[model samples]
Target: MTPNPTNAPARLGVQLQPQHANYTQIRDAVLRMEDLGVDVVFNWDHFFPLSGDREGLHFEAWTMLGAWAEQTERVEFGTLVNCNSYRNADLQADMARTLDHISAKGGDTGRFIFGTGSGWFERDYDEYGYEFGTVGSRLDDLAEALPRVKARWAKLNPAPTRGIPIMIGGKGEQKTLRLVAEHADIWHSFVAPGDLQHKLDVLARWGEKVGRDVSGITISNELSRGSLDDGHADALYAAGVRLFTLGLSGPHYDDTPVRHWLAWRDRKNREAGVGAAA
Candidate 1:
């Protein structure tokens, strides 16, 4: 395993689930999250509702991403984990590149990160006419698709205005971690503290085998607090888990936790001696 970094710690983020929110609400929430000091803002890619009404007001991921690019100024943006099985690899790269351009309209192109995973949600594929294959087969497809995605980015007419970060999300050790080492600029997993540590160790081993520096890849996970004193946030942070994300539902988009998380983000940044944004 590669040695762990003892440098400055990780940062915080939020996953704004777009299923429950209308376009106006999501746009407002993105602006609010930026103002609240979120380092990254994410939206999951799924056609149907993950929670609430099964037929709730839903929005497509990439198109909403274009809107997010236009609306937010400072917050980094991307899908939490776009299913690779849904779209062709080259097309995915093109969409990401286009979003990169859209987000950086005023010279901030590095604001987009393409966070993707092997497809698991069958409903998305079934309704969309995508091939819903076995998990192993899907992983195989993702493995094959990633190289083509990168190569297509290189071959695009304008190319991406910046090197848009590639984030691979999953906890499958043999395939996913190896893929992270091979292709990801960031690695996202939902494992808890102890499990997350183990996976990081595994990822480091994969990194070494692939001759890649694992430290450059940011580690991210989801977060929620029932109360302000919850120890979950601190524990994850201490474990070298930056990019903490809180999921938000809509129609009633409560800003309470969002406010608290921003406060936490500022405190962490201060402890690391990074100047708080004014």
Candidate 2:
């Protein structure tokens, strides 16, 4: 884990929920987001939409990531949180490496973030022929898979275009935090600002036990799902969050919400004396 100090530069990420929109609409949205200067763009790893119609129009995550690699120029793109249950760890490593190369503008410098999590949505498993294990077992699987992922990256032919940042999402104090302390370059969680301090405290303990300085791990928080304005981003920053993400659902993905968050992000970045483009 790359232990970044608590004062890491503020950044913004946008998650493009792959549901209800056709490929053209999704593609256009992604391009528009890049133009708006989000530091990262993401899509989730799931076979179906998480809300509003379980059987809604949805696209696979990694394949679309591959598309994002070809589509955008500057913004880093990735899975908001890939479920590790679907494929072998080594294969994922190879895919990440490939995407890294594809996103690289100058020969080999990819902008791919490997954000992943243990499988949670059970329907993705039942329908896809994966063994739907209990939560603990799934976490165990994630813990086991990540090292293999790194190892595979090391052994890949051309290697990744650059060091891929591993962003692990979850707030499980016992296993997830420990994994973040051990493996994550970015720690993503849904904990609101009021609850963030305690999670950070736990993460620090995990860091101490793991003998890793998690201060370098970039903190990521999600924007409130229902609102358009900034809710706790500033508070989260005060509590050490540097990456604020907002996810948009589709069919008709209004750019209004994203633009609002972008405005908030710009203000925060200006205050921090950092360019929002990075």
Candidate 3:
């Protein structure tokens, strides 16, 4: 289910890409991010390194998410965007349900948000022995898979405490945006500020045509130093975006950008007269 936007003021999240960092460092960074008031944390699903040294130590995403579920107390967690091609729909649903149970630990279970995308990284497909079909075919697979995922979630023995939120990430207008309108609780994209507004306009149009209210769907965009400073966040926020994610890469896991964004997030919430839930 889509979360109530009015419940929290806008929230800030960080993605700790597990490409270069060791398990200890990655775990420690998540702890620190939670302490520093990040509302959500995530890691990408990939077996090999995405940057820096190609052969750098890397970890599987869902396994790391299980570890994270046990480690953090206040922060919500999930894959920044799990590739749909990597796992079967039922398996992904089961994994998400298990993570939800692990994170909730006898409490409320709305903590896990399953952020996924139609796979794009070709190298992952080649290395993992999955068929790397055309983009259209992959999107078709994703379209078919989403319903099966939802069905499996319902059929699981211990159902998700609360329906786990489904976040669909991509900017493809025809297929991706249509799927977002039909199935996503959250929609993530990386378009520029100007283009974001236009794309969102299109998304809303699609939602209206499908009789869905796009207003309930959270929109997320990646945060970087220059991009955030270029009025991208402000523009997107004005365009109905609420959840903002900053990607942190490497062995260092520099906190400077994260700190700056947190400050910015707080200020924005204050200016808007809303207290964000931690």
| lDDT over C-alpha atoms for residue 24 of model 1 | 87
| 60 Cα displacement, candidate 2 (Å) | 0.8
Per-residue CA lDDT of model 1 for 89-144, tens digit only, reads 99999999888887885665658989999978888888889889898999999999
Assess candidate 1 and give its TM-score to the true structure: 0.93
lDDT of 2 by residue, 83-193 (tens): 999999999999999999989986648899999999899889999999998999999999999999999999999988777999999999999999999999999988878
State model 1's lDDT. 0.82
Off by over 4 Å in 1: 1-6, 225-229, 275-278
> Evaluated with TM-score, which candidate comes out highest?
2
The global C-alpha lDDT for each of the candidates, from Candidate 1 onward, is: 0.82, 0.87, 0.84
What residue runs in model 3 are displaced by over 4 Å at the alpha carbon?
Answer: 1-8, 225-230
Question: lDDT at 159 for candidate 1?
Answer: 86
| Per-residue C-alpha lDDT of model 3 across residues 83-143, encoded as one tens digit per residue | 9998999999999998998899656565788999888888899988999999999999999
User: Can you give the TM-score per candidate against the true fold?
Assistant: 0.93, 0.95, 0.94
